[model samples]
Target: MTLNCLAVDDEPLALGLVCAFIEKTPFLKLTGRFSSAVEALQGLHTQQVDVLFLDIQMPDLTGLELARVLEKSGAQGQGPRIIFTTAFNHFALEGFRVDALDYLLKPFNYEEFLRSATKALTYFELIHKAETPMVQQAPQTQPIREDYLFLKVEYQLIRVAYSDILYIEGLKDYVKVHLLNESKPLLSLTSLKALEEKLPAERFMRVHRSFIVNLEKIGAIARNNIQIGSAHVPIGDQYKDVFSDYVSRWT
Candidate 1:
């Protein structure tokens, strides 16, 4: 997969080097190279970038701060994968927290840059293959079974099984993916609307504005709520009819 890439750095020489490296890489398409983060943000608005080669320290907005802004901007799972390029070693840990794929220490060579770029390439390929829609065959054929979905959590792509899911909670631009196999919920930058599109309609249903539940995980149904484990998920008035129709078919 050819990744549309952008380079953002305060230093002119540094930005030029990144651009040159991108040009030499067969699979990376350089969209733009900017000396200021402000201009890069504008470029981001116009372009569909997949990977970002960014410098950490800058005036007005640091790379870390820009990443936070992008995350909050409601780009959801559509945001570019960031690969931080900094001279300091201290920012390495902070990079991963903001969902950075990798960081290149300054005064680095092409070998180091290629390694990071390859990592981004691998991730994009896996996600694309998984999300690709399967073509329908015959009318009488059985439905395709969905086993799992790859969720972009922080910098990593986590494999979440349909059987392991309890419920999903929406947090504005983010979503909490609760699983039966794990104690901690997987946090992702995506809208409930976007997530609803990714999930299979037969096995998963939106019960409320802020929640989607795994049908198999429902322990009981309360008056206006569905009980799964200890959580009581409310049924939204807008979605009650659809939920009722689905339940009536099974009952």
Candidate 2:
């Protein structure tokens, strides 16, 4: 699938680099390009865009600041997939906190850009697929709630809101749920496999030998490791598919 995209940067060289990157990618369509985030924002209001190429340092509005405002003021909750191009690594975690697609440091090579773009496309594909509920032949559309899951805790069928689930742990046989509000994990006698079946594959994912994490709660992910709150989770060799699937789903 070719993704439509827009770009915003102040420097001519930077703008050229972004446009060139888009040109090299067969699956990316350069719908719009701008030297100002303000102008780009106006274009996005009318244009149907999938991805956004943003530069962090601008004259009046920083890329991060512009993205924050766009997220708050744009079409409901729909916002473009943002890839932040910056020279600083400090902003990487902050970018992810707002669900950024990828972090590309300045003076990025073509191979680096290609890899990031490829990963972004893969992420988008998986997310869109998972969020899509299987269509029943019944001529009626079933509304799929994208923000909640039901976990079986013992004999009790516990309903956990998506926002409340802190993170998931993979035990030898069972998975543990750490709630954002609760003092300790609301231990479930459910295996990770069983729990995963009930949960939305698009948002919740396995990351470690003992962890299946809520992507929303993730602070940052580097290599095969994820940082959720103060705890660090590993991505198991066997479960790398989980990370790949989750990333591909949305980026």
Candidate 3:
């Protein structure tokens, strides 16, 4: 599947380079090229844009501000994914906060550009797969079971077994999946609520607004806290009654 791209940069040279990169990429098509964010906003209204290569610093409207506008107006909740191309490295964190697919430092080579473009390709491919309808229906007697899920981390999708996930922590727009044996948790650009919907209800429970724990992985429970391995997760007051009811059945 080909992704329609838009290149927006105030610098003539920078804009030319990004447009050339988009032209050379096999799966990306350059739909529009604009010198400023305001011009790009107008272009967005005219055509469908799947990915945006934006420069953060502009005279009238900054790339970051434009991203917010798209989030609210375009493509429901899933707006066009952005790949911020800028000279400054400090805006990297802000770019990620806006859910950019990737950030390309200015003066980057074709190889670097391709790497970022490839990430956008992977992201769109995943979205396409998710949106596709199933061919056949399952029998009433037999239900489909999913043992693992693909979590998007940076550019690649990491396959994580449900059994391996100890718990999930929500941090604004991102979620951290704590695994059984892994020392470091896997960070993905998705909310805990979104992940909760994808997880098996029988095996996972929301013990807190910001935390979801694997029911089978819970090691111990005391007061308003749960122990899962070496980590201690707090149980929010709102979820206390439900958790108590679940524990009462086992007791």
Candidate 4:
């Protein structure tokens, strides 16, 4: 998988070096190079960047600040994954806090740069694999069994079975997958709309804009809410008709 990369550094020399490294890597494509985090943030909107090579100590909006901005920006939630490059090693902890793929100490060589780039490549490859829906053809005499999906939680991809899921709650750019027999829901960095496409329609249904419940896990429906064990998920007006139609069948 080719990862479109953006390089951002206040120093022209540093920016050039990172861009050069990106170009040399066969799987990495240099999408844009910026002298400051401000320009890089602006470029992010116009470009299709999968990874970012950023310098931490730039003037105005610093790399760390920019990373925070990107984190909170709902529009940029699924933005480029970061790889911090700086002369100082002090910001390593902060970089990882922002979920940076790698931290490269400055005066680094191509070998060091390549390692970081490769790490980003591996991450994106896993992301692509997880996003892809699995299609299987079963024999006419057999039944199609439900399978599991990978959820990107922080830096790790967690495997979750469809049968174990009781419901899903959308939280902006993230989703909380409530599982059977599990006390806490598995939080994943993904949109509800993206996840809906991967789920089987007959087994899962959206009762609200922010909620998708496992149809089989519904314990009872009372008024405008559906009960799934202890959780009472509200049924949105927009989805009431479809949910009501499904309810009518059993009635």
Candidate 5:
């Protein structure tokens, strides 16, 4: 199905660039464009936009803030999926926090855009298959799922299943990945931030600067620590609020 989509960016050039790119993609149809997210919210009431191209920062409502508002109001009626376009990288987690389907870092090329499009379609199909009779008429867009991810361990490429991973700890230059079936970690020379993008936000969360934990496994929790097996991961002060919402098993 051709995706009816909208674009919202303060920069006219950035907005125009996306419109030009959309003209070349057969599956995407540009339905509307807005410089302000507030206007886009108003447009949502009347237009049929299947996907949303959102900018990170704006005058009144930031893209991340707008996404949170949409999700809270459940405004994603027709799979008007969101893909955040941002200059800053720090808000990556916040993008996922609002369950953004994909994130396109600025200065991206057609290949990157194609990759994001494919991911969006994949999410749409998954939700389409799982929808109930009542809500099926509304857009059945699936959340993004990360299956197998790559990690370099020593001289070999280490493959880790999203479900198999328990948690990760970051050192100065290496990350130690603890798996469900293994005691020792599969080490990588990659940052926790880089690896965070490869996993589904719903399945995994960052509880600390040095630790990322899978929500499914929780042997225990004490104070600000998450327990998986015998290991304890400390929750960072900066991420405490976000992590607290998901650590309900312990709370």
Candidate 6:
């Protein structure tokens, strides 16, 4: 799905970079470019904007203030998916609280921009698909189970087999899928909770808020940590009893 994107920033250079990035991305369509939040809001009223690239700090009306206005106006799900762009790191938490699709720090490269855009693209696609009516109805059939899943990383979809995954680590808004044979972990713009829902419960268990380990990949269990190959994943205090029960059943 091509997102109708609108970019708003006071800095001409930042605006230019974002516009250029949007143009380069195949799934993104630049709907409008505004030098101020006020102009962007006007653009939003005049046309449809599926995604918004907004700067946090602006004169008169900041991006956060604009977002709050949109939220209060009941644009939480109907409005554009926001991706805040700023140089400050402190606004990251606030961005999430505002239900932003992603956060991009200033001076970010095209790669970083692509990651955030891809996330917005994925979200729009999912929402659109759910809203669209299914035309073809066939005979009832069981769902086909899969051993692998596709992950969007660096603008490319990488297939990762469930058997190859050693563990999964949640780092704020992103997740790292560690593989047994691979040295580099696969990174994607997604939450651990989202990933956990995608994975089979019988095979994967959440041992910590920041960790999910493959049942077959556990090598050793030390008091507070579980070893998955060379990686030692910590077991969160709240999850310890549940994990211990699971281990006891197997032992």
Candidate 5's residue-wise lDDT over 1-251, tens digit each? Answer: 67888889999999998877777788888889999898888888897777899998998988887887887787854447788888888877687656577788998888888788776666565455545442644564764443767565542344578889889888866789999878688877677888887678988888888889988886887787878988888989999988767666455
Q: Candidate 2 residues 50-114, lDDT tens each?
A: 88989888877788887788767764247687888888889876776555777889889999988
Q: What is the C-alpha lDDT of each candidate?
A: 0.88, 0.77, 0.88, 0.86, 0.79, 0.87
| Model 3 Cα lDDT, one tens digit per residue, 1-251 | 89999999999999999999999999999999999999998888888888999999998999999988877775524557889999999998888777788899988999999998888888778766644422232434554576888897864567799999999999998999999899999999998999999998999999999999999999999998999999999999999999999999887
Ten-residue stretch with the least lDDT total in model 2 = 150-159
Candidate 1 ranges beyond 4 A from true positions: 1-8, 12-50, 56-81, 86-118, 131-146
Residues 1-251, candidate 1: write the lDDT tens digits: 79999999999898899999999999999989988788888889998999989999999888998888787896625879899999999998788767788889998899999988998998988877665545442343675666888887776677888899999999997899998967899998778899999898888999999999999999998779999998889999999999988889877
Instruction: Compare candidates 3 and 5 on TM-score and give the better one.
Output: 3
Comparing 3 with 4 on TM-score, the higher-scoring candidate is 3
TM-scores for the candidates:
0.64, 0.57, 0.86, 0.58, 0.54, 0.56
Q: Write the per-residue lDDT of candidate 4 for residues 1-251, one digit (tens) a residue.
A: 89999999989888888888899999999989999899988998897888889999989999999999998885345888888889999898787667677789999999999888877777777766655433234334565554877776654457788889999999997899999999999988678999999899999999999999999999999989999999999999999999999999997
Runs in model 2 lying further than 4 Å from the true structure: 74-76, 136-251
Top TM-score prediction, candidate number: 3
- In the order shown, what is each candidate's alpha-carbon RMSD? 5.5, 15.1, 2.8, 6.9, 11.1, 6.1
* Local lDDT at 103 for model 4: 87
Q: Which ten residues in a row have the lowest lDDT in candidate 3?
A: 131-140
Question: How close to the true structure is residue 34 of candidate 3, measured as C-alpha lDDT?
Answer: 97
Residue 246 C-alpha lDDT in model 5: 68
Roughly what TM-score does model 1 have, to 2 decimal places?
0.64
Candidate 6 structure quality by residue, lDDT tens digits, 101-160: 788998999999998998887776755553443322223365445687767564334668
Q: How high is the lDDT of residue 5 in model 2? A: 86
